[model samples]
Target chain A: MKTYIAKRLLGAIPTLIFISMIVFVVIQLPPGDIVTSPLDRMQSQGVELSSEAIQNLRAQYNLDQPLPLQYLSWITNFVTGDMGYSYLFNRPVNELVGERIGYTLLITLSALLFTWAVAIPAGVYSAVRQYSLGDYALTTVMLVGLATPSFLLALIVMYFGYEWFGISIGGLFSPEYRDAPWSLARAGDFLSHLWIPMVVVGLGGTASTMRILRANLLDELNKPYVITARAKGVKPLKLLVKYPLRIAINPFISTIGFLLPTLISGEAIVSIVLNLPTTGPALVQALINQDMYLAGSFLMLLTILTIVGMLISDLLLAWADPRIRYE
Target chain B: MSELKSQDAIESDNILQVRNLAVEFHTETGRTKALQGVSFDVPRGQVTAIIGESGSGKSVTASAIMRLIQPPGRVTAGSIDFAPSGSEPYDVLALVDKDSRLEQLRGDHISMVFQEPMTALAPVYTVGNQVAEAILCHREVSKKVAWDEAANMLQRVGIDDLQRRMQQYPFEFSGGMRQRVVIAMALVCQPDLLICDEPTTALDVTIQAEILTLIRQLKGELNNSVLFITHDIGVVAQLADHVVVMQGGRVLEAGTVRQVLKQPMHPYSKGLMAAIPGLAPKGQRLATVASVVGATDITTAYPLTRLADGRQISLSPSQLKAFGHE
Candidate 1:
């Protein structure tokens, strides 16, 4: 197992590097730089625009350097655990990204747990009550979840929140609690705003997960071992839980690789509709303003997240299924 | 007919009495009749072999007795009466609506060993856990006690290193070893009647002989009645005291092994006897006895005779009839 983990860690190096290169190139290929947008806004404020001032600004931010040299310096700093300053926010990139990573992980993980907890039981019940009215009802609900897009769901949730409870959707925390210290109260306040996005993002994913788990459960239920269990006079519920559920859940756990990426993209849409101060909107804003460093860092973070999710899923697969050999 | 003795004096008391049992499968195309008017008695403390070809309704008969048939297939008629030792006879067909009563009988009074041991045992659980699960289902024993009983059962089935084998999964064992594990599980509760459905057909010849020997030894030790199902007449000769030969869901002939093998009355039974390899020597060119049985249309240049006792008999020209040629 140690050897297997070492091999996996070794394999991740080239993947991270390749991802970094693509993020770097794609963020730089845009038409405008970060300074251009801010400078245009400043000019509208009747400030005198001077070429020398622009040059000084560019030099201070290291934007005047060649793209290759800039990338080399950025890569070296990234490897050393030092993400440079964000040109748009005028703050250290690590601190800015770190604050948002917590929020992203909070919503994503909650949504993941919610999806599994809801889908597994529903899927199994649907399979057990196959062709019955209960099964038909669950199938109808799953179809509705699939038909309604996440963005539209988020919009509907936001409208309901606003009308029913008079809640604000401008950001994750209320205005009074925005800069509060990280405590349970502040965290609870933050989570109140997180519920809508989590539900919206989790609905579509839960439907797909239910469909997959239902198919898997049905297949395992038909296996001869299950029949053997029944012939042993095992109770139907115990047979379903102890034998079929364990084998069937392994395949769904391995599907976490695809599920994680879907969650991230779904979060992006949810954040946009609800105006949460999450990485989704931040990444979009950086791209639109051509903030190469910020955009590249965010993209790299997403790529790293994807790789980590896949690695975790593989490890989980090995843990859940003893038949799988990592070698 | 007087020459054929009833042999009721040698027959053990009946344990299970199945009468007019029929099974039908309700498929999308239509209902398919799988079993038709199958009636037989499984005697106590004796082995009764049900011999037939594939799709001859032998397995279906055993499954119906256990009440294990799934949806789209059901026992449509008749009764399966179970009379346990010192207990009143209860009709199993009447308990279809009362599941608790049926549940009380299965795994405690009756247990079954299926074909293909590789699939009969769960792949994910340890062999010990699977057996313990079976024991605990019918008994109120603690887990530890159940597990110890399971280990003992494994030892009884001739598995060496019982402790180690108990911890292993089904895939870790060979076909013969897996069947032994299955036998251990089936006999753990000391069921009054054990149903084995072609238990050795999936095994190689050597393993098949060993399994048959193991079953015979176990049957002697337990003195429990066994309803063994198989198509191999050789296995029947080695294991069964009494045999019922079935064709197209009907009992073609039934008698003791000696009576059935040496003096088969049914034409289908004679055909089956003639088909057995080595019954006739190589290059002697065994006579094809296809005309007596109408299911297959193979032509034969021979005649079938109606004996004075009214049983149809067919004989090969090379063989002399000890009894007058029907």
Candidate 2:
């Protein structure tokens, strides 16, 4: 198993390099350099922008260096865990990126847990009561969840939050609670506003999982082994859970790789709609300003997350099924 | 005539009676006949083997008795009157639409052993848990008692280190051992009738013999009726008291193993007998029976004369002189 994991990690080097190159080239080809717009805007306002001032700004930000040298410096600093400085925010890119990683992880992890908790039982019940009213009702709800876009759902949820609770529909914390220490009161304030984005992202994802799990369970139910269980006179519910669900859920678990990307992308849209201070909006702003350091750091982090999610899925698959051998 | 009467009397003495049983499958193309009008009786304490080739509907016949046929297939016609001697005979076909009645009969009175041992047993579950499941399904027993009974059943089926083996999954066992586990599960409830469908086909010959012998021993010990299905005549010869030969969804011939083996009457039966390798000489070409031959021609060809009263009078080639056929 160690050898297998080592091999997999070794194989990932080229992949990471490829992702880095794509991110670097795409970010460079854009319309303006980081300081061009702000400098031009300041000059157009009748503020005298001298060549000495512009060159000083360029030298301070490393914009005066050649493109290859800038890329190499970025890579060297990145490998050493120094993400350099943010040109747009005028701070260390690491500090800026680190501040939001916690919030994103909280939302993503909570949504994943919520999705499985609801979707698995729903899928099992739907399969057991197939073609019954319960099955029909669950299926219809799943279809609705699938067809509705998460962003649209997020907006509707925000509107409902404003109308029903009389609470502010945007931002992660209340005005008075902002900048306060982490306590139950602040946490409660955070959670009250957290539900909308969570549901908006989670429910959309749960719908697909429910459908996949239901189909997998239905397929397992038809296998001869299930018939053998029934023939053994096993009670209907026990047989459904023990034989059908246990074997069927493996495929759904392996799909975690595909699901993580959805969660990341969906969180971005949710964070934007709800005005939560997360990496998504920050990454977007960085790209628009051509802040190479902040943008590259965020892209690399996303790439690492995608790779980790896939690895977890593979390990989970091996654990869930005894027939699978890493060697 | 006396044999028929005795067979009828044995029906009252037996556990399950299947009379004129037929099953058909409704396909997208049309309703394909799976089992034609077939009739046989499983005696109280003996094995009755139903031997046939693939697609000859032997499995369908067993599935029909259990009333487990799925959509696109059903018990289209005929009756499966299961008379557990001294009790009222319940019509299996009548229970086709009544799930409660079928559920009541299944696992409690009629249990089945499927063909593929590996696929027949749930892969995720331990062998003992699966066995205990059968006992718990019919009886309102506690987990401890059910598990104990399952362990006992495993021992009865000749599994050593029963406690250890019980905890292992189906994949951990060899092909022969898996079949034994399956048999233990089926017989754990000690149902009156055990339906085995090609139970030994997936096993190697040595293991096949062991499984067949184990089944025979278990049937003897339990004194239960077995409806054994197989295409191997050799297996049928080893296990059956009576043999029913089937082909193309029809019963071509049925009689005592001695009668079927020594003197097969139907053309299909003759073909099957002739096709048994090593039974005939290597150089000599065995006579192949024609396709259109029927039961009426069988009587004349074999010269097993039937009396006016419908008694089958056996006449050998040398005994033909007595009937003045020579």
Cα lDDT tens digits for candidate 1, A1-327: 667667777899899998898788888787767788888899999897799999999888788999889899999998898887777787888888887877787788888988998899989989877888988899899889989999988888778778998987757888889988889988888777777777888888888888888888888886868876776778877888888888989888777777877888889878888887788888888788787767778888888888888888878887666556423
**Across residues B160-255, which tens digit of lDDT does each residue of candidate 1 receive?**
897788887888899999999989988998989898999998999999999999999999999899999999989899898778777666555566
B-chain TM-score of model 2: 0.84
Largest DockQ belongs to which candidate? 1
CAPRI quality level assigned to candidate 1 from its DockQ score: acceptable
Clashing pairs in 2: none
Residue B59's C-alpha lDDT in candidate 1? 91
What's the lDDT of the predicted structure labeled candidate 2?
0.79
Interface RMSD of 1: 1.5
- Interface root-mean-square deviation for each candidate? 1.5, 1.8
For each candidate, give its TM-score against the true structure. 0.88, 0.81
The best candidate in terms of lDDT: 1
On TM-score, the candidate that comes out on top is 1
